[model samples]
Target: MKLLTHNMLTSKCLKGVNVGYPLGIVAKDVKVLETEFNSEFVSRIIPKLDWDTLWNAADSIGHAGDLPRAVCDDYENDVEFLKKVHHVLVEVEVIEGELVCPESGRKFSINKGIPNMLLNEDEL
Candidate 1:
């Protein structure tokens, strides 16, 4: 999954999980592919993302590149900053990994870049 997806993923659906946000990543494999950069799209999506989660996820998988810990002031107008954001948010892919819930430690396996978030009946 892309960091954009990771930034929004949550394990709150699990039983007894109050806030299952910012799921931990255990990336056994990661890939960085070239993608077309759209500055406007990156700028528009920035507000919807959790910056810390994105950074941490990228760092965990060693794909953080030059992304900053904090979104800068006037980021929309900053081309270089936007490019960096676009790379992390769009280009990096988790080829094989598991996403762990922070609250419950329940693991969701990612296969071929697709995360299996479906829970067993008991887990739900």
Candidate 2:
């Protein structure tokens, strides 16, 4: 899964989980499959994301590189910053990993860049 998707995923569906957001990542395999960068798209997406969560997620996986810790005052026209955001948002893929819920400690596995978020019968 991309870090962009990880930023929004939550484990709140599980029983007793209040705010199961910002799931913890245990990445066993990480791949940087570079892709075309679109500054406009990145510009639009930055507003929807939680900056801290994105940075933390990337940092956890050791792919943070030189990504800025905070978004600058002027971002849209900043090509370099946008490029870094685009790289982390789309290029980085978790080929094999597990997402752990912050509240219930439930683990969801990711194989081939797909996260299995389905819960067992009793978990729901």
Candidate 3:
């Protein structure tokens, strides 16, 4: 899944898991493919992204250095920043592995670029 998708995901297995968001990426396989840049999209996405979470996810996949500390501040107007955001949000794809929730330790596995978030009946 793209970091854009990851940005919106949070663990829902339990109600009280404070750190449910920002699921830790444990990718056994990953790919980065280039896409056409669109600054408008990046600028619009800045407010929705979690900087720390995106940074950590990018770091896990070896794409961390390009991102700034804040996506909405100094870098918002910078072309380079928008490029980095495009790369992080569009280029990277997780082919396989588990996204472990920081709080509950629930594992959401990704296969063929699709994340399986379905829970057992007990979990619901």
Candidate 4:
């Protein structure tokens, strides 16, 4: 899955998880696929992202150097910054990994670019 999708996912569906946001990424294999960059689209998505979580996830997969620690207030006008965000959100792909739920420590495996978010009956 792409980091953009990961930013919006959570484990809230699991039992006893009050806030399951920002599932941790444990990427075994990662790939960067080239895509046309649209600064406008990246700007639009910035507000919706959890900056800290995105930063950490990118850091985990060795792609955090270009991203700033915090999303700057004037990010919308910063072309260089926007490009970095675009690369991280759109180009980076997690081919093999596990997304760990912070609250329950549940692991969701990702294989061949597909993340298996299914939970067992008891987990529900």
Q: List the candidates' TM-scores in order.
A: 0.97, 0.98, 0.89, 0.94
- State, as a TM-score between 0 and 1, how close model 3 is to the true structure: 0.89
Query: Highest TM-score among the candidates is held by which one?
Result: 2
Report residue 109 deviation for candidate 1 (angstroms).
0.3
Clashing residue pairs found in predicted model 3: none
lDDT of 1 by residue, 58-123 (tens): 998888878898999999999999999999998999989999999989999999999999989998
Better of 1 and 2 by lDDT: 2
lDDT of 4: 0.92
- lDDT tens digits by residue: candidate 3, 1-124: 9888898898866555765787888998888889999998888888777878888889888887657766555665798879988999889999898888888888999999999888877666
Q: What lDDT is reached at residue 47 by model 4?
A: 90
Residue lDDT tens for model 4, 1-124: 9998999899999999989888988989999999998989999999998989889989988988779999988998999999999999989999999999999999999999999999999988
* Clash count list over all predictions: 0, 0, 0, 0
lDDT of 3: 0.83
Q: Give me the displacement of residue 61 in model 2, in angstroms.
A: 0.2
Alpha carbon lDDT at 76, candidate 2: 93
User: In model 4, what is the error at residue 105, expressed in angstroms?
Assistant: 1.2
Give the lDDT of residue 38 in candidate 3.
90
Best by lDDT: 2
Error of 1 at 50 (Å): 0.7
lDDT of 1: 0.93
1 against 4, candidate with superior TM-score: 1
